[model samples]
Target: MFARDSRLRQWLGQWLPKRPVTRRDSPATARGGQGDVDRVRRQYLESEQRFRALLESLPKVAVQGYDRDRRVIYWNEASTRLYGYSSDEAQGELLEDLIIPDAMRDGVIAAHRAWIHESVEIPAGELELRHQSGELVPVFSHHVMLNEHTDEPLMFCVDVDLSDQKRAHRDLEFATRFDRLTHLPNRQTFEADLDEVLDGCRRRGLGLALLYLDIDRFVEINDALGYEEGDRLLIELSRRLSEQLRATDLMSRVSGDEFVLAFPGVHREDDVMRVLHKVQEVFRRPFGLEGHKRSITASLGICLFPDNGAGARELIRNADVAKNQAKLEGRGGLRFFHQHLHDDLVRQHRLAESLERALDNNELFLHYQPQVSAASGRIENLEALLRWEPLPGQPVSPQEFIPVAERSGLIHRLGDWVMEETCRQRAQWRDAGVKLERIDINFSGRQMGRHDVFERLEAHLRRYRLGPREIGIELTENVLIEADARILEGLHSLHHRGFRIAIDDFGTGYSSLSYLKQFPVTSLKIDRSFVRDAPGQPEDRAIMEAAVFIGHRLGLEVVAEGVENAEQLALVRDIHCDLVQGFYFYRPMPADAIERLLVGGVQSLGSLSN
Candidate 1:
């Protein structure tokens, strides 16, 4: 409507028949042809009547009749209501002066004259004409020229108000095509646009890339500030990113702190990298938020057109999959979409769904690996390892499913189950006069987020009438390093309660010694990678020896993992490591096997060694 509607003028140019006028001054009337003149008068009157009837059928349509001079000769009641002019006041007014906008008045006058003198008809469609009060009014108008053969030809315009329809169309377009806050293209609109670009790419044999960008730790930042501030941050971030995009490229705020961008004609990995570099540069600049400049980092995932996927949805999914993998590696990293990555994500998703029902379906169980005293060759402790078999003899390794559990938030339940089962088994062992000094269960950092973690452990211990000394909790070095105040406090309380605290797979995380100082840990388990080369590699051996010295200096017991050879075992013993845990002596076994072995007698490591 208004001047912005490019189609209105084109859509208004269809057929409208011209009617000839009957003039009493014609030659027929002056040449003694009174009958013919009378017949023409009757025909003109009949045509007027039919036009009036049409006006009556459309009460809301404004009808105005003008003479060849463009002076109003007829104005209907609807015209008075629509243009804020009484029929009496409008009768002798010039058509352009009365209703046409100043800018369009010239064109409207020229068109009217053409219809009157040149046998042209201004057909029907939408227009925005001025009202008496000067506001623009959207209307669908039909123009008809009557009496084209006579000098006193007249024109009538029938206009139907299109205000409501225009408003509705504008509102629907805004709702569906644009994001409310950022005013960027929405996910649906972006996808539809990508579909069009993809069609063009297919025809032109071109390549494109779709990138999924996610701001790291945005949720935490959002929670720290208020939601209103968060929204502003998003708006500002989107603006800056938009400034970096090319005019031809398209970007969409697909979710909170996540944007999807399409780059057409990108052919190589280096080309994709250059685009990603620009994106990373945007993040590197500090953003203004709540009177503060906060630096942020984002991870980007990229998928190529006709290589990763042909369709928009598939490409977006693949890019998102790559983004997730990049997130796993840490902030500001990028990953390319590949088939194997997509396949793994699909498998992980399916595994997570199945793992939800794993416990109740009795598909989950634990195998305990023993930690033996290197000095006495006697069992010192057992580490509980979770194992899963969705079907008989088809065990899914922890490497495959543990991450699935963590991502799915099933780790909390699984952790509790392991603690409860271990405690219950210990109670049963106590009942059979079998002494089990300490059994540790592993924990992922995700499990520590549960507010009831300490309570759940206490409940399990209390239910089984077990002491805290008999249950140890093993956490990876990374978990302890990333521990927040609540997690640190909870672990401290557990340590204070005499539940043994062990840092498992030590020296494998960032600054392991600093975490050992920060976290209240009682023992350290050297990572298998370090232990595997302890005998031959001086660097590895020196690292292990240093770890033992540091642990002892801190009054923490140190154990070596992956002791699968006599050389590795002897090295651990020579270093005076507190314990040795590996397949050399015994592999991880089910509870029943451990129970049978414990009941028989003291297990001799020397006799079991290969």
Candidate 2:
């Protein structure tokens, strides 16, 4: 390579004009003049070598030069490699006839003529040029025009292939619009498509329907079967839903186990109902996953365009509202958007705002409900039930405000307050000679998931000068079933420390008898629905009896809740219920009333039939 470079330089130097040396005054002066000429030639050769190296270094960028007549003057090695032509063949050829596609040849010539005649600079951008093999290659071309005080201008073009960049961009765009697990359009693409469809409907005077669906008890399923299985279930569900969709319908996975369907050109409500019913039918078949059959159910909500609001955002919001209503009523059902739903949303918003102030404003308090031994009628424990009496208007029921608290993320703070207050009150009662076996406090599901709840509870217990056994933790069935590793560890720690754990509202959720063995639980409380009509309904009696028998077999204390009359109490007593709590014994009352009952003795509590 060095010899070739030196030979090329010698050949090029042969055409250069030599400077006339001045008449030599002496031999020394002639020698100095010769040395100056040699130095200049050496510098010129070095500069040319550097320029050639720079051009060769740019292997990915093709460089080509053209003259005023639009014929190629220079082509580099990159140009040869990019266009699949030898550098010798590429030079001295018209760019239009060589690389420009037939359709673009005229435009290419026009742009070149304008650049040469009108001295206009050509704009640089992406274009397709043909390769020597006749395949089209996408490139980003930049044009450099140079004149250097000459009549004829020269244009040098630099092109870079865009195949890899284009492919990467396409892959990124696909990833953003689709779900990784289900390969369905994700929430972002769903909203974008909905906006476009809504605009078209407004212009064409067509009606549209939006259906929002949520898998019922999906969390419990995920907890039981594992996340991998849960993901497989989602993939299967997306495939089933796609098979049932019409060409005009679009579906998206908007949330974890939540899907939205958009149906355009629906002329009547019946059309929408027909499609939603079909969606429900998809869940009827059990998902066969890894040797297990999982039954699935969905709650669906429907909203019509122009009736539920014209905008996409408003329509989706209303659809979600209806979906929640259906879920609340029960799963495997459908509901349509209504004005009353808007009213309920507003009411819930106000109630959520009010609850934020309940703790600080002294509006939040607890009422003690006595759970007495069915055999002895002796009060065994006082369950601290949360009550809210706001600054103005009617007091909110726990059934109403608790859900609001959970949604608003105020449950953690509210629950902390409840725990401390309950412990403090129990201590105060103990100091005043009012005593019981233990005080039961309801634990929120939100609290169980928090890693710091144990530390917070320990602080409260220390502040009240109480031991772990002084308070019992009452958790619902779902909370126990869905308890994660950290929560399970925390519960076991509490249990080991002598805090009794009880399942509240048993038999309502996931009803897996396995939960009895899985959690560190010591007692079960039969929900009131079974006891309210136990004597009249043989089935209810049978259920209570079975619960009692199971509780005894598991060595767990069984308590029957909501025994409101003599018949109910007598029935529970006959069934050997360990404890009973209801309005019939005493409505949940203030601390003063509970203290009075505590001081009045067990016989005073027993003579309440008067």
Candidate 3:
């Protein structure tokens, strides 16, 4: 049996084991087999060594592995090169201790547990690692759990330095939130900070304050000087405001000449008063810019938290409403939010909405006021004035609707309609042999700023088949104050097209004489305010005389408006005014009514001198 078993073993060895195998011989054979095992072991060691060398030689990325407890077990040489640490120094280190900030350690551990238990893939995301030099290096790390036996887990991580990416993202965020001109937080940042502060206040049962501030007469300064000087002044103002604010306060530039302040922990009304007083005092000091010393004042409005509003948006709205009230009452003052202010804002909003639909609903019409020659006392031109005849049970004054139209961006369309209607009426009068010399249409400040003003005017002239010489555009001083290059270009184009330009309500704005020489103006209409008291007021007379003299010197035809009496007319004629139009001559009448008098001539109408 032993011999047979030995033979069987030997046969088995020959077939499967590849060696002679007797029970004792098998033991001897096993001893010889150790040499072959050592050779195979040596080969595996050499191959593994070559693989480790190749992995360390590659410059692709840094790699590290950690056990379930977050203890580093393996760290490649690339980890040393990328993180300023040797593999020996990093190995056996707790990953949380090496890479995670103390504040973020709990979150990192939670994420690792989730990755292990859920077998979830944690994608590449930014993390901060402490290097051998103790400096934090931002890195994009991709991590995954390796459950080799589907039991104990190991975390493998590949890290890429994201310092450049982090810096770029920070810079982009700053640029988006900060204004380059004033270097203050912009409107977007202001709104974000406001929301955060309001949320914090609500959560913590704290008080907050909001201040809406607008620079008074900023537009006038911008118009009189230039944008560069204006920007410099705003920067200086921002610096001063920054100095005045507390560390917890945030100041932001919300718009051109408007700023918003958010003050958290402002629990008392006196604190708001104190800040406003400081702002006023700081602004009262004169600012020197480009060889000019100028002083500016701000209108400020305050809205308190929990009292005026419950949230950021409502607080800002209430503050804005109060600010407008401050402007309406008088600029360079401060006001607090009141319920009545909200009512007023609601009314204004409704009115603005109604005005938006006014033109579409055919509620707008034109009233023709005769423009009689001062010398001949004959109606030669008609000035078309805008009138808002609202729907039944509603009546909107031009004073109300005109400003609304300007604010709502509807003035351009409304002005075009007025121009078309005026030209059509003029053409009708001409066809009836009324012999109208010109039809003057009023242009808003917005219309003058339109880039397509010239094109639109030309189209209207062609549409009515009227000559450019037969129409005149009357612009207020506000138009020139807008002072856009496009406006000047549009006016020049109109002049080149043979359309006459008249400065309406002249002498009411800054440097009228300077603009008269600068612009290609054909006529000057003295403002009615000056004319209303001209006969009695010596100042008014002197202003009128100076205006008339300036007009003649500049070779501009002077027209006096608001001549209510013969006495005023005598004053106008004495100043050698070229034309006159007012209630005394004739009130604004319908197109057909004006046509009848025009066809009949001066003899058919009553005396205009009155």
- Against the true structure, what is each candidate's TM-score? 0.76, 0.77, 0.69
lDDT of candidate model 1 versus the reference? 0.83
Clashing pairs in 1: 19-147, 21-147
Off by over 4 Å in 3: 1-74, 88-131, 134-209, 214-242, 247-259, 264-273, 280-300, 304-310, 321-344, 478-498, 511-518, 535-555, 565-576, 601-610
Q: In candidate 2, how many Å is residue 78 off?
A: 2.6
Candidate 1 wrong stretches, greater than 4 Å: 1-129, 133-135, 138-169, 601-610
Query: Across residues 1-610, which tens digit of lDDT does each residue of candidate 3 receive?
Result: 0011334234322322122222444677787877767776676666667656755775646667789888898788878876776778778888878766677778778777767676445555667776777778887676645552467666667677677788899988989999878878888788888888788888899998889999998887888788888898899888998998888888898889988888898859688777777888888789986687877888889999889998767888899889987886666978899988898667777887777677779887888898777877788688998887668647677887777678778888888898889888888877877777898888887766777877888898888899877999888876776667877877887788778889898888876467778887889999999999888899999999999999999988899999877788888988899998887788887777777777773342325324
The model with the greater TM-score, 2 or 3, is 2
Who wins the TM-score comparison?
Answer: 2
The residue-by-residue lDDT of candidate 1 on 60-92, one tens digit each, is 888788888989988888888789999899989
Candidate 3, residue 126: lDDT: 67
**What's the lDDT of the predicted structure labeled candidate 3?**
0.79
Worst 10 residues of 1 by lDDT: 9-18
**What digit string (tens of lDDT, one per residue) describes model 2 on residues 1-610?**
0011334335434432344444546777676777777887786677667666766788898878788776898788888888998878977899888899999988888987776677565666788899999998888887765661368766677788786787888888988998878888888898888898989999999999899999998897788888888898899999999999888788999999999998898759679778877888898899987687878899999989988887778888999999989998877868999989978888988988888877878899999888888877778898999998888868889999998888778989898999889989988877877767788999889777778988888898899898877888899999988788989998899988888999999877885698787789999999999998788999989989999999999999999999888888889989999998887787798888888888873343344663
